[model samples]
Target chain A: MGEQLRKTPYHDLHVRNGGKMVPFAGWSMPVQFRNGILHEHRKVRGSAGVFDVSHMGRIYFRGPGAVAFVNYLITNNLERIGRGRLLYGALCNHDGGIIDDVTVYHLGDEILMVVNAANADAVWKWASELKPGDVEMVDATSDLAQIALQGPQAESCLAAPFDAAVKDVGYYGYAHVSWEGAQILISRNGYTGEDGFEIYVPTQLAVPLWETLFRWGSAAQLEPVGLGARDSLRMEVNYALYGNELNTDVSPLEAGLRWVVKLKKGDFVGREALLAQKKAGLRRTLVGFEVAGKRLPRHGHPIRSGAEEIGVVTSGGYCPSLDRGMGMGFVPPELAEIGTPLAIDARGALLEAKVVERPFYRKGSVKR
Target chain B: MEFPERLRYTKEHEWVRVEGDEVVFGITDFAQDQLGDIVYIELPEPGASLQRMDAFGSVEAVKTVTDLYAPVSCEVVAVNEALTDDPARVNNSPYGDGWMVRAKLGDAAQLDELLSAEAYQKLVAELGG
Candidate 1:
């Protein structure tokens, strides 16, 4: 606990707002705020909320071969997503296992790839090693601060201060605009399954921008949310987290992410292994399930068919939106079908659960 | 934040209030504060026997679950029914309305193994501080 954990630019600000700091990855970050996770989660769904996402690794890919290098390193079809588009995909190992789930922003001149905080260093090193001589990779994490402003009223809350014209930004689209006289990037996509924006700004202006947004959005009930609700919001929408659903031990195919893998678009890392696995057929697949009772399933909790431990939960918790327990787990292909019943041996108590469809929380205002 | 002076405490952050031959126990305020909002609690059924320092229940927070340990040997006499529908009470009124179980003491002398109010305060200062 005494280890000197890295602190973001907004670390002290979070503490001032009653954030309960916890060690996440290599940084001391807020897990929850004064209002607790349930309140913060619902607030984001109803009005607006802000989250400090500066902990994620931000890398810049520039030069002639940037797009080709990115296309070769990750599974997403970059050719289909033009400039100013945000693409979500994963970098995989040679064995077809997920190295890290990443989000790439096509900035036209330079490609900006955002990776998980824990996997940033390793992924950067991996990318730097394999990069062609024509491409240049630069780590810009220390110079930038990223904030996710989310919810239905999220845009209107800050429409005036940061610019009100962002309402026209399409889903997965971003705009590089002048904010408070300085240039910054604002993406329409958010992790909460809500209509919001992810803004990137210089590190020195982080606090000023935060204060301005909060001051302007206070009328709209803009709360400073922590990572606790950020996790639940993403999980409810079936977004795969790097450590939970996507890891080196799990393949994208097995994790229900086959749509992103571009087999027909040419060669990439892990392409051969994924091809072989496709032909071999999948033995296990990730499935979402709804628990029958209040006994919530947790990560590593065993999933059972009667007495046999068939699989384990990757992410599980109370879905405050549904007012019920929800979970995601890996089960045999036979048990992966919708409506198939299973049991979660949470700690020791057995709770009945059934396989459900993706995006467990369907009322998200993502399109709105 | 405030530990009651009348109750005996465990290093695990459990408070025991001795009443007649029955001893009622619940997690201390410090424990509940540390746990954040308690979402669920699994308590041992009434009439269950527990040895000193044995785990009889657990409380789940948003991110973690903490097993509740018995401070002394006892027979479960009463279980809190309110907590099933409203686990947040443990965070609201951790000492009073949040009391988890009532048990008949196996040996009243086992209370000696617990830290006194003063001793528990010092322990918390040294540990959580």
Candidate 2:
């Protein structure tokens, strides 16, 4: 497994700091550190936590046709976004099926797409096929490393490193700042539902930057987080994961990402199919439910409405914050209503569950 | 990782201590350390019958879950109700307050098949615990 798995630039640092390296999306990533997922999670919620997200793919689109090509490929309307703003949307196939969920950063002249690690190569290949000759596509995944500083103290922790006014970067906004004479990109957004910054730096500076953040943010109790805590954090906020919620088989509408789908905006990939899907109505929709029992509903677990198996759990686990077994899964429209009673068949035992409003842990300081 | 000398062990990483006709059991320290920050635990109720090597309960950590196997056939006399409210006890005290179940021993001969502290340590070492 180690031979096939790819390591990030901070691999040595992760191992030295007791990050339990595990196989994830063809990359060997730290699932959790020596402090454990619970500790790391509380650190992010209470103070600050840093994540080495270099494993995610960064594809840059440049040249004359860059904006037009990106506008046509993604479901969200890019014309609404200005330079230095970030947009979250999905790349859908012509049939309205989600190809991959992406976070597109409008960095003035170039567009940087941060895609999931599992779908990096696949996304690149898919885009390359549709890429126009005028647009130059460059996969900068190996050239640069990304770090996420999350929590309420994220601004202060990140601000200590640079003289630039990082606090000015509003939610879903970004700015280029210089640290140690090297220019780096800092985006005020994250998946943890915290006030955070996603830093993009050159590969060679990854280690020094990681060390500097810890040194600067030690007073705020910032620690290195891993994928395990990352998953739990996102689940708490009901954020959709790549294979879990948004997949090739599911449409973005059914995955509860209708906000990103701009039907009024000009035609784009999956526009027709999505319009057709809208006319036909969604057969199954994603719903958040909490298990009443101690046992958690895991992925692929059967979800039942009375005695009949209605749907399958797309993502399920014990939310450390909520202190309950909660998860999101696809169920029929009739059963997707909040307050609807449901059940998760955990092996032979049927745990009582109920559909509830998303973001199982709500008190996130995402905007503030 | 404490492997108590008086306790008997299984390859699945459960430990049992025999006292007269009854036995007390729980997961080993190494097992808890590997599982990391247990959030929930599912255990059989009192009076539940168990067979040797049968899954009597399960430990749910944040990332994954594992079944706790019964070391010997017995009737569950009581369960550690404290774990329901505070599951982290298993991580904080795997050998002490984290004890899962108290049961009446069905066969005294099954104890011979269990590994001693020294032998269990070797097994843990082989598994890179």
Candidate 3:
């Protein structure tokens, strides 16, 4: 608490735009603007919204062993995706507990790993100790600034500013675009579950790029969003947040991220433990539930079934787009079935909730 | 943010008003501004008794929750039902239609303990409002 919080390149811009700043993952970041989180959330779902994602750590890997090294580090099969594409996976310890969930971007000669800001140092330390002689690592977090332009109008919002055919970027695919002497990487991906683009720009060009996007996107109703809306937007789609759904105490399999784990692709850091856990069967699994009332179910709230205290809430809050209270939590497999009735202890009040499908909102345009 | 000159206030950021035999209160504009957009509110039912400084209700913003403290000892006579469907009133009209609870005034001396608008504004300024 005595240490000074890190600030992103857009810190001044955010403050000038009426952003309500808060401490998040060691960074002084905006939780919402004057329009508030609800407006920003709906803007992303209906039109477009831009977010400063520079706080997330970006590490670039190169050399002949880059591909092999990343494959060994993550649970996903890198062979499944070719150059210009990215895959979501988790980095786990030998005990199969997740260290952090990351998105690995394959760029042919170089590979980029985007990690959670809170676990950046831990992840870098873990990778550094396991680095091969032929592999090279570059922590480009401070050197670059990232922005995510998202929603139904994302393509139109981004098309006019860059040289590349922004609409042609496939989901999870990226393209290198040159803009006014600046080299930028635009990836057609986002955490909001909307059709969007994540742009990685040089730190020096970050402010200009952000202003340019807004100036060009003004016609498309693009607004600046913050972490408050960002959290709710991802929770609506049942995305697993690192510290909440995944942590040193939780396994990827138990977190309902099995699709990213390719055990058949040969050896990985947590392969043996994952295999052992698979054989033993999971005792608890992550499930999404919707509360019957308006009370926002918060993290660490106790989950009760009849008279027994079963589990605890990981990510829970009011989903502004859905206009309801929903959340994700880990519970016994039998209790995770859809339609299972549950209650969350919010303070002394019990909020009624029921287990539902994986995603609380299924109308996202990410795959469109 | 508007602070009504007629109302008294507490350090917790709640504004108080004495209306004939009843007293009305709500979170101050500064409190609402600090809380960002309010999403939900939970207040005690009518006839619920509360002591001075007791938590009688709660206000829920998108990212956080804050307890609403009582300004003085009283019996809750009525709660603002409008907030049940539109909690944003706390952010939009904290001093007007957004009032939280109406109660029969208790221990008139407690009213003297509440800060006047001038004094409340000073408190807010000291808190870096």
Top-scoring candidate (DockQ): 2
Kindly list the per-residue Cα lDDT of model 1 for residues A1-368, writing each as its tens digit. Answer: 68889999999999999999999999999999998998899999999899999999999999999998999999988888889788888899899999898999998877999999999988988898899999999899999999999999987876776564576778889888787778888999889999898989999888998898888898887889999999999989998888888899899999999988888889999999999999999979999999996778899999999789999999998888987789998999999889999999988889899999999998888873
Error of 2 at A207 (Å): 0.4
Quick one: ranking by lDDT, best first?
A: 3, 2, 1
User: How well is each residue in A1-368 modelled by candidate 3, as lDDT tens digits?
Assistant: 68789999999999999998889999999999999988999999999999999999999999999999999999999988989899889999999999999999999988999999999999999999999999999999999999999898888877776535677788889988888798899999889889998999999999998998988898886788999899999999988999899998889999999999999998999999999999999989999999997788999999999989999999998888788889999999999989999999999899999999978888987874
Best-fitting candidate, measured by TM-score? 3
TM score of chain A per candidate: 0.98, 0.98, 0.98
Each prediction's interface RMSD? 1.3, 0.8, 1.0
Docking class of 1: medium
Residue A192's lDDT within candidate 3 is 82
State which candidate, 1 or 2, has the greater lDDT. 2
Candidate 1 colliding pairs? none
Cα lDDT of model 3 by residue, B1-129, tens digit? 677899999999999999987899999999998988899999999999999999988998988899989999999999999999999998999988899999998888999999999999998998878
- TM-score of model 1 (first chain only): 0.98
CA-lDDT, candidates in order: 0.90, 0.91, 0.92
Candidate 1: interface RMSD equals: 1.3
DockQ (Cα-based) for each candidate: 0.62, 0.88, 0.84
The DockQ-based CAPRI class assigned to model 2 is: high
